[model samples]
Target: MYAATRIKNRQRVCRTLVAALLMSAGAGAASAQDQPTISMAINQSPWLDSFVAMVDQYEEETGNRVELDVTPFGGLLEKIRNSVRASQGSYDIVNVNSLWLSEIYSGGFLAPLGEIEANYQLPEGVLSYGNTTNWDASAATFSSDGALMGVPVNGNVQVLYYNTEIYEQFGLKPPKTWDDLFANAKAIQEGGEYYGFVPRAARDSIVYNFTPYLFSHDAAFFRITGPDQAEVTLNSPEGLKALETYVKIATEAGPPGPGNIAQGELIQLMATGKGAQAIAVIAAWGQLEDPNASRVVGKINAALLPAGPDGMIASSAGHWVAGIPKNVAPEKQKAALAFLDWFAQKERQVDYVRAGGVPVRGDITGADLGDEAAFRFIEAYSQNARHAVMGLPFASAAEASDAMALSFNRAVIGELTQVQALNQAAADLAGVLERAGFTVSKLPDL
Candidate 1:
């Protein structure tokens, strides 16, 4: 019900903005060449700190100022939406999740990045997969009519973190398949010193844990046939099976009170050596590997998520994508591209890696991947990265994500059966699509 209200409100905002754009087209045309004083949005992370430092260096070298503003992820999105509605162009560049791509662009609020991309050579290994001519096959977060509209600034994937000593003590190797993971984890728990697996089973992180498995089995939240297209596709047998598998793992191998395990707390359990294995995002593990910050130091090993019946397991790509605001001046947009190209440089990216950015470049893997566990992570990321799911552009992504959480939360507490939980979720998702006037026929088949 909350989701339905949010959808209605968003549509009204979009409608008002469209009418305003039509009335101000001429004024907008004239302001296109003005010097673009840019405002940018970022989620808090170590990489963001590095980004600010680099921006300072660039300003010093070029004598042109680029203002850097930081906001929580939620606050940033709200501000961007409100600013665009007012035709204020408060932000010149924004780092956002993939689902925001279509809505922002369709609202005539974001500028296409093709002109910027073509004007400068992008850094090597920085979203090279997304730069190809055939965009559907590329890893780009947003593409339309053969043009890439965003640049990937981070490498995001789910991976397994295990204790090396636990594996060796049990004479076990890193799990290459889901069954292997289950067996190894179960046996290791016999010592009673640690549990076999720890996962983020909480409401906030349930989708992150479940969606990849669904996609690996060739299922998805929506089917898309085009940019302005999408339809519900979660009711299929494959999707149900995937959800069943997710419930099985959590029920069998995950810690007690699993639904209470928030993402941060779950990772912290793994880092402190209370658990032998964890399924989580790469960034969290990377922080644990840092000696200065981590309490476990030199104990945990990160590896690939094991395969499912279909093939190797897949993960979602949660990247920070950069796009220009349509309101920004053209020359400034050009400069922003130049800055992005340089910022994405492999050498500069090394700085990002040192600051704990996931290695996005292929050549940097293997020997260049440094220490043993880090290599394990990079290897898994390289193999599974291509299969990672791109988030959908629902009118209310936050709402949909929340609904998914509620269903899983109920299942976690044994309040609902797997079938009941997913059934409720599917109905909620369908209602959201209908309310937004979005048809599932436009999305890609899972």
Candidate 2:
């Protein structure tokens, strides 16, 4: 009975989504000569080729043209900001990072998907695979006040990648906790063939690499105390401990010039066997199996990140989503939504995964991928995404992240002690919130 009920429910969702799609098509149907060209801004990454292929398929099937402007992940947000400020319909569809969604939505630059289709509902599986609480609180990321805003294209989470040969050589088991990770890193470093671990520590990348440690140790930038009151909380003992652990790893066991490392470099370091382990985005794992890019193709293995003192595996969700800008013509808006609807279908999503993109739908993650190691890693990542948090969801998230990055990079370079760094970060964050019109109380001393 339970199985039957589930099947019926899934069929119902499919029917509803299909109905919405048909409605969208009918609403926008016009003379063939009146169709407008659509363009999209996408991030250049491992998945770019796959997305391009999908877009080609879209064009072939719909007789519509889409120009793709591929930009580096670091620059995409700034590009969107500039375009929105000018009210230029530079692109009909825009790729958005989860952390940047609140800013874009609050800026009034997005056309609420709800307004486009009032009865449209996300597939049950998509919601099941995301951080449900966050999806509710910051609905703008996926939907705003029950209106869909974007379709998630990539589901990202941090995982630990280790060199199996190195672990066995040193008699080390996969780390179950942060202490184990540190000890293993130190041992691997002392053993001399490779650095113990390599993690992204560049100014822009440090916050992402540090979040797991911070959350595992029960530290956060702010804690809501009342209906509208909050306090900075990153100067507590847990915060200091997490920062100290990060600094020790970077200075003692990481590669020379730790501050210069970013995700691409870190991946190469691991793939070239220069590093024994890396804690990075799971999406990069696909590259590790590429013969053209990796030397240690079969030598690498992945696992859920080590837990913290609280015995919880804390990961950050860095999923990428696609939204339509409000500046586009109404016809272009409809075309963009039509494209998004087709791209997010289950069959296309599966094709995307097979072609090197990360799948954000639960059914896709749970599907049998035939490769045991690949399936195991993706399964772990999917589980992590459900509980992960994208910290600092306010419009000032970028500013807050920058402040934390400065403090973290300072600690990495030995300019400040862990306590000093975190305290300074807390103060910086408080100032950011205050300027944004939120009342923040002073954090208690550790």
Candidate 3:
């Protein structure tokens, strides 16, 4: 009954919204075309609760109409793609994940913010993802010379999360390397108290979860050779070693059916006190301390992800970005610009974190939210963001990542040996890059 009433209320709200828009078109000195009425497309994510409330506040404060279209993470890409292709302005603003940045921007479907605001500059304290949002067509890579296409919506990067109580019980220190992690996780799992690890090995996101391991082991999916050129390098000795450790830890210390684990499941494992540790995005920190959402609140502590073979941490930058769609009409573009203009305000950065969204500006990352515990992970988050690597940033990033993800999932599921998966993935990635017009070659398979 409540669900039905809520749906009806939503319908009524939509009707009222449309009516208000019509009335404003005739009443305001600013033309209806110049009004900041827009539909923003975003994925339903862990941070949606805070973001929605913030959007409501924006509407209430400015009296501008905004239609937020939420979609599942998987379908968001296609929705943005189809909307851009239609060229009818179904959405004025679109969410762009770091992985999708190259693909969407390189295709010329999104307009640069500079084109909308000639005097534009990213707000102070905005965290940098050097050139990831800026695409250089001539070089076929993110470069300083590229068009500045998007702004950081949230700063998210993988961080090592662990149960401090579990570590205390085990008399263990934090894991700093792959071998250290493996040994510690094995010990915890054998203690029979809780899972020692829970990686996000789901096929849809395995590449993201696996990136730190690959980089730490000194392996890469593709090595940039020159402008518009790369070589598939995943089948190298380092990658083989990385995969071996990844599979070994997931199977020996992680919950069964490891290949099916994603962010939600990983969070549940830790939140319910069933798991001891995992490397997960810092955005998860928001819900970890809420009494209703977590039983182990305040028991969780974060650190840098385990260092690689080279003794360097290599967490992947997974920040979501916001940009305008080029296919939209000029009026819609201006409407989108107004929203971004509001977004660029520094005061809103603090409000964003308090409302559960991660802020991109480093200066305000540690802003007080009345609850000291709310941003306890800010130190680790900021450190990780500073060193985060851009994962598979290129026009064919999706295709390449998909191919790699499939092989990684199969390996985790025991459907294929790690080496077989790596070789298959490398070959598949090579083909993907070659077809995308990148001059691709292959490193000798291990």
Candidate 4:
């Protein structure tokens, strides 16, 4: 509710600012065709706040104006989808989560940035504009057949967070392996005073939290063996074992009403020292880092994510990218690129970092943040990326994620055995994908 409210209030403020800008410029009724006014829509993120500040700086220098539209995270996707489908050009540049890049590019809704990048002289010490973590900033998400949509804005990582006081009191070392994690969780929960672990089991949290385990077990959502053979791969032995591990820790170490625990509550429980450990997004640690937000500030420590039999720590990347709209005027597109180039400067990136954005470039690490816990999170996240998975379409992702949540809830409640739950989940998921027109032959036959 707080995040939603913040998003609403932020939108109100942005609208007021844009209205004021329009009034000062003495323009009325959408002013003459392609007269240099640009519109941008972004979800409420601190990184975007910094980006807006950069936009202001760019405007002052170039005399180019930008009208920003801000919305809540929940509302942003729907808005983008509706607007892009109409080709109404509602947004000149849109800020979106990295996961949605494929869908946006594939839909042919976004404009190419290749020509624009070639024309602009980016600020010093910045990667070329439109760079995302998925391809090292050199490659674009689209094939030669499509436009280069979405410029990468911020980079976020996932890490394992633990309660320092709890570990110390129980004489438990940070878990290095899944076996150690299970043993430690059981030992810590034996006292029955508090829960030892909490896995995100509600809605989307399930997939965000579960993907790493699958990766650690050396499984993937689809076999990228070939474009023609991409298929579902969630039922293999390793995949089933990964799901089993989730059932073991969540059912055994979590609270009885496990399905009711939302991401915020889980984080709060960990921050208030109730949970012994959890795998959390890097930005989540900022809550513990804040003196007013965390009661146990110094009593928290971050560790690298644990390994499974494969010895690889799986993680997800949360990032934002800016892309142009299809059929947009070349001059307007050039202006967007100029603005983006300025926004990617090192100094501006530092500003974004200070405002809570994890840097996308590899140069910023533990040394960059200067906070021990934050540094630890960076170290863990950087190492874990070796096993990171790419994101799929937003709606498909939400559906796929919900399937895992339902299975997890059932397993945690003992309504189904782990294998039974995973098998059922695999079957249901295969049906869902088939309906969505995906093939199931090349993926692991779980």
Candidate 5:
């Protein structure tokens, strides 16, 4: 009879503990529902899918509802611009590409992140990984009125991706310079096994893909001389060399109809083993490793872009920053800032990498990721980022990129020589700067 009584007493204690836990969870849920719902606008890329999954966790913990507007990248900027101009509080938080930061900030579309930084006690340089400093002078592109405008969330740079199996079969090594790249590409294409190299040539994307080549040769469309002054340099000797190399790669060894290839198509060509090599954004690394999508999964290696005549390796920087729109309601802004705080925490950033998004925090990037191969690629990407230069940062950067793209396209299609294409491009870029109220300097003869 004493043993039975002890058993009953134990059962009674377990039931009481369960009831208390349930009560606590219910209370937490009640508190979560008290806050207003937040709406966010983000790209519809795979990276954003991972981010949305994380947002789901945040919502469950805080009891705040979040509505996501996942839009295609092409139309996202115009959508945000219109909403901000109309002061429509449709989105409490928005994602801003580094390229568009100047236009967005200059238009008073984003709230200054200064108060949020102080409230959270965020450390200096917390948002930057690799060689990018949080408040460097270059960061002025994303700031306005002497205040930070956004928190960086993604870091990207261009890298060369090559098929290791193909290289080994051909008894070859990766190229170290543009000349080496051309020679290897020619030899591989002549072998008739695979196309030598592939890259995006679409007019809208050609400039981005061509930047590493241009920078390697120390060429630029415009050189910033001061805060508001820039000089046209697209017709320089370096510019001609870079353009000639770019055209030769596509004309001599690239796949048929190279003028139509875009970033996505270039990645697909490499992933499926059709192309032996490619130069693309670091984000493509994940796609190359996806077993379901890639035939060459685990058979590819990434490296820094090849050097130019100057023996310098340069890449274009492209990252995304998150900000609260000025049109957001006051209370909603607090909620959005709270979410940013949670998202930027180092531990959370590490988790984000595991979920397929790149981490922009140095601590997280340098952490011990359990996957060895992934860590190696991240290391390479971070190293390449160290040598990256930002694309044009002015409000008219889009127009300037368009000018360069058109010139590159014409040259790639044999419509004009490299010198002719670059000269015309320089003239167009000068027009863009002149309209933006900056004096354009005369170009020397090539």
Candidate 6:
């Protein structure tokens, strides 16, 4: 409720500011066309406050009206689908999650940055994930030879989050390895005060949560065996080992009934002090510090995710990028580009972090924001993002992710053994890849 109220207040303030700017600029309806009103279709996120602040500043300074069509996370794709597929949709700018990049790319819904602006180039030192901005349309895959579809706006990573007080109580420092984390989690769980860890097992969360495990272990959904080959490896020995460990972590060390926790539920559990640790998204750090929303206000802290036995530290990179829809007017596209350019400035990115957004720029995240930067997540996120990788980057990424979610959920809930789950997932992935025009027959039957 507080968040809702805050957003409402911000909207009111933004409208007032925009009205004042229009008045000062003598912007009658006749002059309004001079300042384009580009609209964005975005998912409501933990960094909404930051996003609104950024937009507010953009509108006031440029005299351009920007309307945000915010939707719930689950509804984001549907909203984008409705807008892009229409003869003339309402959204000029479409927020692209890396996981959905291929879907949007394959459908030809978004205009490449180069297409929108002939001279477009990624800003120096700006991190782009999974070839998100680059797309080979003919092959429906991310490639350096492809067009620039968008610019990354958020650099969200999975970082290790723990209760400082709990660690201090148990003489534990933040874990640097999976073994260390497992031991600490077991100790905390046995103490009977809190669940050692909370997991995100909700259907939407499983694929991302599981991918880091696979990556850290040097296992993958499939390795590129040839120029266009996707060999099923999720049921390989290494993959099996990773899945087994993940299941043990979730079922043996996590809370009772750990199979259904979603992103919000996991955050709430940690905030309420019911959970001692987790590998959670950097964006979620905001709510954990909100006095009214969290009981563990200052108790929680973040660290880089633990390394696997081989010492590889992999983290999930599911960033959000902004792409201009091809369906929008040319003026709107230019306006959208203007906003993207404004947001990408280094100074503006720092301001965004202050307003509660996790910026994609490395320089800003690595900078010292000072001791005055209280109750914020910066260092840990900075460390984690350095090792982050796009969990699943494929033309059929959505379907592939859904398969992982289903199998992981089954394993978590004890409905399927870890081995069976991996077997099913590997077979499902092969079919998904083959149907999407990739070679998938290399693997021996799992």
- In candidate 2, how many Å is residue 154 off? 2.2
- Candidate 3: regions farther than 4 A off: 1-35, 60-63, 329-332, 413-416
Residue-by-residue lDDT tens digits, candidate 6, 392-411? 66768888888778888999
lDDT of 3 by residue, 1-446 (tens): 12222323454422121112122222111222337578888887877655665565456556676677878899999988898888486888898888888888878888877787685556666776645757777776777677777777778889999999999999999888989988889999999989988889999889989998988888777777888788888899988988998999999897999999988899988899998999999888766777899989989999878887788778888998888988888778877776665554556656666666777766654544444675778777777776677768787787788888998999999999999999999999988888888888898876
lDDT of 5 by residue, 1-446 (tens): 11212322433422111111121233223333446777777776757655765565556566666777767899999878877777566787788776776677666677766654453334343444222222224433432224656666676678888888988888888899999888888888999989999968889789888888888898777776766577898789898999899899988987988888998899999989989998888889889999989999889988878899989888887778777888877778767776666666655565567667776654544445765575557766766766777656567888888877887898898888888888888888898988877767948756
lDDT for each residue of candidate 1 in 290-348, tens digit (9 for 90 to 100): 67666676777777677777774677666567767777667767666655654565554
Estimate, for each residue in 245-333, the C-alpha lDDT of model 2 and write its tens digit: 88888889979989889888999899898999988888878788878999988788877787888887778778787888888888888
TM-score of 3: 0.84
lDDT of 5: 0.72
lDDT of 4 at 404: 57
Candidate 1, position 279, lDDT: 80
Error of 3 at 244 (Å): 2.7
* 94 Cα displacement, candidate 1 (Å): 1.1
Please, what are the lDDT tens digits per residue for candidate 4 over residues 1-446? 12222433554434112111222221111122234867777777645554555455445445667777877788988878877777466777787776676566656676656655553322333322223322211222323233445456666556778887888888999888887898888988997876888777775567667777887898866542333224567777888888888778887887767666777888898877788888777667778777888877777777777888968776765557777776566777766765565556554454456545555444456655555354455555555544445533322555665665677567766787777777766776666655555555533334
Better of 1 and 4 by TM-score: 1
lDDT of 2: 0.73
Q: lDDT of each model, Cα atoms only?
A: 0.62, 0.73, 0.77, 0.63, 0.72, 0.77
Q: Which stretches of candidate 2 lie over 4 Å from their true place?
A: 1-37, 61-65, 72-75, 85-88, 127-147, 224-229, 365-367, 372-376
Stretches off by above 4 angstroms in model 4 are 1-37, 46-65, 118-148, 224-229, 369-376, 385-387, 391-395, 442-446
TM-score of 6: 0.87
Summed over model 6, clashes come to 0
Which residue pairs collide in model 4, if any? Answer: 130-151, 151-322, 235-446, 236-446
